[model samples]
Target: MTTADDFRALHERPEPFLLPNPWDAGTARLLAHLGFPALATTSLGVANVVGRTRATRAEILANVREIAEATPLPVNADLENGFADDPAEAAQMIAEAADAGAVGASIEDHTGDRATPIYEFGLAVDRVRAAVETARQRSVVLTARCENLWLGVNDLSDTIKRLQAFEEAGADVLYAPGLRTLEEIRAVVSSVGKPVNVVMGFADPSITLEQLAEAGVRRISIGAALSRLALKSFVDGAREMLAGRFGFVGELPPITELQQAFD
Candidate 1:
């Protein structure tokens, strides 16, 4: 299968595939070595690495190109809000991402303003349509994300309606982050009829993979959770060193092992 087909097939599996989000080339290579079928770049993770509140399109595209070239597995970019308020500009950015070697990408409906968090319904659908049409030209998988749930909208019906519109707008995958219940997850998955991606880690820790699969989720991603975990380790180590303790050094992976993975 082609790279695009291979990435698309991961969502078609009977069991939901785990798509870990990696922030950089090192993390991408390490995750690929661990045998994940595909990797998605975390916008938060990349922002943290670059010390930016949010990464620019140029920054994200550079990271995407690096990770895509660093591993054989397909890489999906978190192209948050398509980096533009205009639909045509958003569509052009999607095409640029495809040209940078991302087999898959996501466009979210978040409006970047907490007071008016999500885009208006019609405009959101138009944005997804624009992104999808551009992605289709490059044979890229486009995942349309409805930010309602995460933006405090808390309306499952509205979220599902947006997802349905996105599906009809030609999104290959549907995602509504912050869905907490099995019923909520299943509702969106059933309503969309396309592959549904659920973001894990922020949800209840007790929810198992099987539970999500049973809810009909087609793919799972841990958006920035891994990056946060890594940062926690570093912070803890630094704290111990400041206290004159050296024990944290013992917890690190051997340099040779990291070198081998990178090689």
Candidate 2:
């Protein structure tokens, strides 16, 4: 089966599975070697590595290609806002992402304009529809994201409305990244008939995988959390060194283990 088919099958499993986002090829290979079923590319992670606030389609595709080449696991790309305000351009971006070896991709409703914050509801739905059509032609899994939660619009009712509309627009999976409570997550999953992908960072500590599965989540992704954690270690180690402490090196994985992981 193609990686796209394999990725689609992952959502059909009896329980939800974790899809960790890796920032680079090395991290992708290491995560695959550590036994993750699939991997995702974090746009935030990509932006950070490239020393920019945002990444262009060409940059994202390059990262996607590198990750796909580094591991056997299927790779999903975070195609933020589809890289365009026009539906046709958004659809074209999805096609390009598929060409870069992404088995799955996400298109968010955020417009990238701080003043406007998000696309109007009608336009957002159309954008997702266009992307979904393109993904269908390419056999790539399309994830439609509602950015209300992340865009400072913390309205659950509206978020549900957008997700439902996106589902009708033919999105294979629905996602809203900033949901904080199980009640909110379950409500989204129950309202959308399709598979729901939930972001799993800064979530309620009481919530567990079993709880999420029981609530009907089909996929869980840690977008940029792994990358942030890796950066946290580096920053902390550097700060300690500036304070005359070099103990952070002891926390590093053995050199032999690193070599073996890549081997």
Candidate 3:
């Protein structure tokens, strides 16, 4: 059984773990075949697949259960913002997530607002604390996300300060999604001594995976890059066909690939 213990063990490995986010069963199985130590579900991808704007608590749990049942790899549920307005409600959702077979999960501090993107600091900490307490009962590893960088706060010192508080509040992993610079990443990794998850796709140039590992990043994730890549290919190919560039539509994936995917 791929239990929470298995997910916890990945962190103890010497090299920084790379977990690709998958939305559906096919993607999950492919990731498992790729020998990933674990897999994570992307909320945006799930929402898009289901033709919904966002995920409800019920929908996310159902999806988590489906992905967990489809693969043996430890599955990490991206429980976006905990899916609740109240801390207690969020904690309850975390327990439900564990029941659905999530080995671990993340609770973001983003408010989904452009103007005021992140939650109030104190409330965010309380929310993370609630999630940790709930997950502790099931031994579900809880990751706390600080969205300051993603929201363009761009203050490394403040980001470290918040993450240190999250670590104290019982987060097993500390993540800042938009951190691109080595200095910011190193500072966060150094400040709390907790495993950090950085987004693989970065703007204004980026540090390589090896360099990030040296800089002390313990995990790397490509949030929705795969989905974007797939969409880009489809859109670009259609545009070429419409513009009488049929020859440009070269050989796509083999039929065997699709058959095996469903098989």
How close is each model in CA RMSD to the real structure?
Answer: 1.1, 1.1, 2.0
Residues 1-263, candidate 2: write the lDDT tens digits.
87778999999998999999999989998898889999999988898897786887788888988998899899898989877899989888888888888889999999999999889999999999999999999999999999988778989999999999999999999999899899999899889899999998746767899999999999999888998898888899999999999999888889887787798
Of candidate 2, the 10-residue stretch with the lowest lDDT total is: 198-207
Position 182, candidate 3: lDDT: 86
RMSD of candidate 3 to true structure, Å: 2.0
Model 1 has an lDDT value of 0.89
* Model 3 spans > 4 angstroms off: 51-53, 203-206, 259-262
| Residue 11 miss distance in model 2 (angstroms) | 0.5
Q: Cα lDDT of all candidates, in order? A: 0.89, 0.90, 0.82
Write candidate 1's Cα lDDT for 65-125 as tens digits.
Answer: 9889999899898999988878888888788888889999999999898888899999999
Residue-level lDDT tens digits of model 3 in 121-142: 8999999998899889888988
Decoy 1 TM-score against native: 0.97
Extract clashing residue pairs from model 3: none
Question: 1 or 3: which has the higher lDDT?
Answer: 1
Error of 3 at 162 (Å): 1.0
Off by over 4 Å in 2: none
Q: Please give the ranking of all candidate structures by TM-score, highest first, separated by commas.
A: 2, 1, 3
